[model samples]
Target chain A: MNSSSSGNVGIVIVSHSPKIAEGAADMVRQMVGNAVPLAWTGGDIDGGLGTNVAGILEAIETAWSPAGVAVLVDLGGAETNSEMAVEMLPEDRRARVVVCNAPVVEGAVIAATESSGGSPLAAVKRSAEEFYA
Target chain B: MHDAHASRPGETPVPLTASAVLVNKVGLHARPSIKLTQCAKGFTAKIELALAADGPWTDAKSPVKVMRVKAPQGATLHFRVAGPDGKAALAAVLALVHDGFGEV
Candidate 1:
């Protein structure tokens, strides 16, 4: 993980399938390069299809930045697990992270793009959420 | 070049237009579309893109919208840019496409 005090917001991608999470992260890396911090998690602890709360927590830490971290989840389980992961954090750290209601892949890519351009956490979340709006 | 003269009050700004081919091997797929959107957002211009010279333009600054264009290799991309920085925006976008999105 880079410095959490960095100016750029970080991103976390969660999905039921590891491939989906990895592919989305790949697209983000390709477009944004190393401009923003990014991490992703998917599949259950046993390597089957599912979302793992512990893994989600680890990913959030891996991508942490004081600017903020936007978590994009693919399915309901992923979202719920991401929320649980957030709840597991300390009070102040919890506020810096948000689980975005968005289409996971697109949202992550857009969130990362905005973050790469040095947009704040709120702006990054807004741009990614605009897809639903 | 475009007519960049200031418009009279209540007059609509003259939009600058240009065309470029999608010369990259994959055209405007996910990666290219993301690059295009990121590039478009860097400017203050309101930019839109269409498959032809007229009609059905999509916001170029939206990655999803641009990806939906699903343009293939050899496809021509038409652009309409309107703003104080429209000319520069159009130039940058055109240059990106002309360079095959740095993939050619």
Candidate 2:
């Protein structure tokens, strides 16, 4: 099931600060190149420091891959918002997504690298979660 | 202690082993640890790495265990690999370490 150019898994990063999310995405890109799909969203719709369900949903769509998608977020509220965004997706798509419990930056980089190697959603999530281990 | 030349008829030879000092400034940090783990996963050998000469060995495929070594710069890392591809795996890991994980 080829999706993007690389046909590997994708990653979505969510953070309370736009800069933090963008920075983490950039780090992932630097480490993994363009072989993996990567998208990120942060800050509220009004440009404040907070999470937005709509922005996260759009990011997930932007980085969507038939292989699957792993969402990494910063803090509990961001995680909550990310879960809500995933729930808003269609059942078929939602089932293919996972909200990883890992550090945002480290998880993004590790997930992207594993995904670039054509790992499945579960493997990618495990790699990211191992960041805490 | 057993004689170095002594060997049983069906016993497998001892594992191939090597040691190298971590020259990278950050030692086995997150990025380098990930790289090492990924490389180790490529081989079917049972690979293990220890921080010191006689330190406890941990599975090289486990990123968490590798990171837990916390080997700083100039710390010697000993590797023991046992399997069909043990020799090749040891060489590959040694090469990566000698290259300073491409950090320098």
Candidate 3:
């Protein structure tokens, strides 16, 4: 886990399928290189098709950026789990985290690129949300 | 010639515009869109990308808007840039497009 530098927002991808999350993160990495901090968690502790709150929490912690962190989930359940993971963080840390309402692959790519450019948390979240617009 | 003489200091720099075809196999999909958006952000100029040469431009700085063009292979992408660095921006973007985004 690389430490996130100041002014760089991080990205976390959550998905029911480990392949989906990992693949999306890989695509983002290829596009933005190491300019942004990124982490991801998918599947359950048993390696089944489900979201794991603990895994999500660890991903967020590993990719924690002082600028902020954006989480992109694949489905509603994953979104809920991601939200719960955020809630488990210290109050101050939780405030800087956002569970974005956007598609996993597209949102991760856009958010990662936006973060690489040193945009604020709000702008990064906006970039992901723009996928829906 | 006449336009150059008519322009005065403090006035806005003339916009640099160009059009190029999407030669990459995938067109402006995720990879290229991400690259294009990141490149656009590198410059301070205002950049717009449109599917047609005439109008209806979208901010090139936005990945979603760039992808919204939904341009397939062989489609033309028009770029309009304005600001002090518009020429550089236009040239860089055109070079990237002509390079087939490193595709082939």
Candidate 4:
């Protein structure tokens, strides 16, 4: 749902269920428009109901931005796997990426909204985390 | 002492206020909430939204907080803004709500 929008902070959504990931991405696209780079991933190699580190890494790659990338996960496993994916990033790229402690659906919307507004990675992460505040 | 989080400063001007009915079919749902936050963030004023006039205000620039209000249709939304751009900020948000977020 995003295209031709670069330089803005990117957002990657991770969930155990593929549908949840896609649905959240859809919501983000609808609310934030196509101004922010975005991607979603879930399930394992066989596309079952579980988090996949490789898929998450691919999603991060797809959503990567010079501005930065914020990763939102649905569950503990998703977050853990996303952390592994971030760790897999090149040393220089790792600093530009972060895994947020926020609700997946709501955080994706808030983060994408913040990113669409050209907010930096920290602000977008803070905006998403505010859901818990 | 200067406090950045203070609701009102010692020499602050009185806040501008406005109210609008949530006429959209689904009230302030995700799309509308995001739009409201975007509109509010365009200004430098301190904007807050509440169901009643007295308290329980939430930052209008936060989509999550705005959506959390879950204001169903027909709910009256009260707004308070304080800053040099308070008047324009209040007017913009009120207009967005008055238009029902472009939803008929």
TM-score of chain B of each: 0.88, 0.86, 0.87, 0.88
Write one digit per residue (lDDT tens) for candidate 3, span B44-64: 889999888887999999988
Error of 4 at A10 (Å): 1.0
Residue range A1-133, candidate 1, lDDT tens digits: 2324356898999999999999998877877677888899999999999999999999999898888899999988998899999999989999999988789988998898878767888888987898898
Candidate 4, clashing residue pairs? none
Better of 2 and 3 by lDDT: 3
lDDT of 2 by residue, B1-104 (tens): 34542364432368778899899999998778877877887778889999865758898876666877888999899999887677888999999999999997
Backbone clashes in candidate 4 total 0
lDDT per residue as tens, model 3, A10-62: 99999999999999888888877788888988998999999999999999988
Alpha-carbon deviation at A67 in model 2, angstroms: 2.5
**lDDT by residue for model 2 (A72-94), tens:** 99998799999999999999999
Candidate 1 off by > 4 Å = A1-6, A17-19, A43-49, A129-133, B1-13
How close is every model to the real structure, measured as TM-score?
Answer: 0.81, 0.82, 0.88, 0.87
The top-ranked prediction according to TM-score is 3
How many clashes show up per model?
Answer: 1, 0, 0, 0
Residues B1-104 of candidate 1 have per-residue lDDT tens digits of 23444544432377888899899999899788878888888888899999999948999987767888899999999999988788888999999999988888
RMSD of each: 4.2, 4.9, 3.5, 3.4
**What is model 4's native contact fraction?**
0.58
Find the 10 residues in a row with the least total lDDT in model 2 chain B.
B3-12
Whichever of 3 and 4 has more TM-score, that candidate is 3
The predicted structure with the larger TM-score, 2 or 3, is 3
Candidate 2 chain A least-lDDT 10 residues: A1-10
